[model samples]
Target: MGYEWLALAAAFLWAISSLISVTPARHLGPFSYSRWRMGCTAVMLTIMALIVGGWGSVSTAHVMPMVLSGLIGIFIGDTALFACMNRMGPRQAGLLFSCHAVFSAILGYWLFNETWHLAEIIGATLVFSGVVTAIFFGRKGSDNNDWEALHGKLAIGVALGLLAALCQALGGIIAKPVMQTDINPIAASAIRMITAFAAHSLFWASGAKLAKSKNPINRKIFSITALNGFLAMAVGMTLILYALQDGNVGMVALLSSTTPIMVLPLLWFITKQRPNHYAWFGAILAVIGTGLIVS
Candidate 1:
């Protein structure tokens, strides 16, 4: 299949992984989950890189960018995302995380001197409007709820989601420059995973001591976390690398941002939490916007 198609597959897998992650995330703290997830991804990708002979071409010149990409995208991005999921629930968090495309587009333009067409701008605006509208209007609780209570964790979640988007955007831009060098994408991804694993380990070690006595890391959570990590690395990173190989960063980012659309249906089917009219409208708009931008 074409690189764009690969990217689309990657996005779909990521969406499925995200939906799967929510169940385990509910049981485990975001930090703990993120720690294990990154660790597993690091191991899995390392083995893949070695098996495919992708690691033989790695060099020092590619090290920093790859490491930084991992630190920003995997460590910070996933950690913030999990935190958002814990605070805002999956739907709201997913909507907010969709802003990653916009951030990535802007960053790609600034960093790579990529040009944006009017159609792209219009499409992105539509997607952003749809996602924000869904988030604001489709809240679960009643209006009488105090702003302090309703806003606290959810607001934090949104902010963190925005931060994660920015980090991912920056990391994507960083990865682009390095991809032009001698380093192969798979090896670069492996390097990134290593740094991410280290950072996550530090976080986990520091936090584990203070975790509540009843903290649970059962078989189900472990399995899901492992699956999430493996798919994210093996599929998500591979597709992203391929997309960057033949596509503009803005287009690739926008296309991949459709993941939430892929995910929402799974969430609805599994949980029976049907989205309201506004959410459905937003999802449609998002899909249209992504198509226009990518086209």
Candidate 2:
């Protein structure tokens, strides 16, 4: 039961890492930023695996799904998300991103035949609803990119957002059977990171496309992206695997949906202003949901 708390912690860690990534993502562009971040994460995970000597757990059965998880989740899902963010803005894109929980829950049931208890069902619903509410009416962006701005760009963003959700959900589902086994979550994360980083590297090397913003990858950019990669990829992803290793994949996925809600305090601290009171209620709802999920 206590292990469920790790999922909550993962939500916070991801929120922090996402906040830290804005500067680098803007500086290097999302694709470049993610590429560098993946490399840093791979290095971090590799070092940890070496120290623990847990690389021996990976087998032929675990390899393909883990690699495919990396490809679908990190490579395809994240790339689509970045594009959605560019077109729809973070808040708008996030509103759609919240749907990952629904996709995760459905896929977990359909693919793995995973079922939830009554408490788990109630808990996940509340958390998912709360996050959606919080994101919809939470922080007002500076540029005021309304979710209702349904232009061509917005349409594309919506489509990409859904696609990202599906990819992410499927990725998590794919990883569940492997993670539920005796494999170390840290090692699992390392394998996935290596897979994702290698794939992105090949894509870049192929010159299939170039970033919209061809900003030079400066040293500072590298440092920040590396930091972000450590938090978001190394820590956050490890906790995700750890959660899924012992808990219901659907429940873990929904719990991880709290990242945006977790961002409220950080926003308040950074801006010297409070989040919308509406967000506080949403937070309360999510906490109650957490209780039910863990009960």
Candidate 3:
């Protein structure tokens, strides 16, 4: 399959993972879930690295950039995402997180001088506008102040999601320079994961007592976090890197940005919470935009 197709598949898997993660986030705090996700990803990637080449391909020059990318993308970006998910719910958080495409596109353009065609730009704009409309204006039978307060909270969540997106985009751009080196993608990813693990360890070490007191860990939370780590970080990110191997970074990011669209139907199926019509429209626009950009 083409990289675009692989990216789409990854997006679907990520969406499912996100939906599933929300369940655990409700019980275990976002930081707890993030710690589990990062830790598991580090372990899995380390095993893969050992089996593949034992870091023989990795160079000292590439190490720092990979570490920075991992810190920003996995440690910071993912933590912010989980926080937004907890505060804003899955739908709104997913929609806002979709802005990763825009941020990636901008960073790719600046970093690599990638340019977009008119059709691609128009398609992206349409998709983004549709998503914003759906998130802000598509509520049904809600005129209460509480509803307004929800919208306000969603706005803040969206802002944080955008910040995460920016970090992810910059991380990808920074990774590109490293990818151009002789380092293997798998090894590079492992290095990144190692750094992420270290950063997260520090975070947890400093906040362990507070986290334990605030949100006690339970069986269900651990199970969900483990599942999220496998699906979202390990499988999804591996597939993304594979896709990037065959395509432009911007196209890969755009295609992968459809994760929110994929999540909508899965949410409906799992939670029986169908997206509003506007959301459905936005999802369609996102798919179409991805096609235009990638093709």
Q: Candidate 1: misplaced stretches above 4 Å?
A: 1-3, 133-152, 207-214, 293-295
lDDT per residue (tens digit) for residues 1-295 in model 1: 6555666777788888877787676677777777777778778888888888988888777788788888998788877887777676665677778778788877887777888689977887776776666655655542332211233555677798888778777778778877766666777888887898798777556766523222678887788889988787766886797678767787677767667667656766875666567767877887778677656
How much is 106 displaced in model 2, in angstroms? 0.7
Candidate 2 structure quality by residue, lDDT tens digits, 20-73:
766677666667777888989999999998889878887888889899999998
- Checking candidate 3 for backbone clashes, the offending pairs are none
lDDT of 3 by residue, 134-236 (tens): 5544444323312113433656777778877877777777787777666777777777777877877787778665243246777777777778888887778
Residue 260 in candidate 1 has what lDDT?
67
- Local lDDT at 203 for model 3: 70
* Best candidate, lDDT: 2
Q: In model 1, which range of ten residues has the least summed lDDT?
A: 142-151
* lDDT (Cα atoms) of all candidates against the true structure: 0.73, 0.79, 0.72
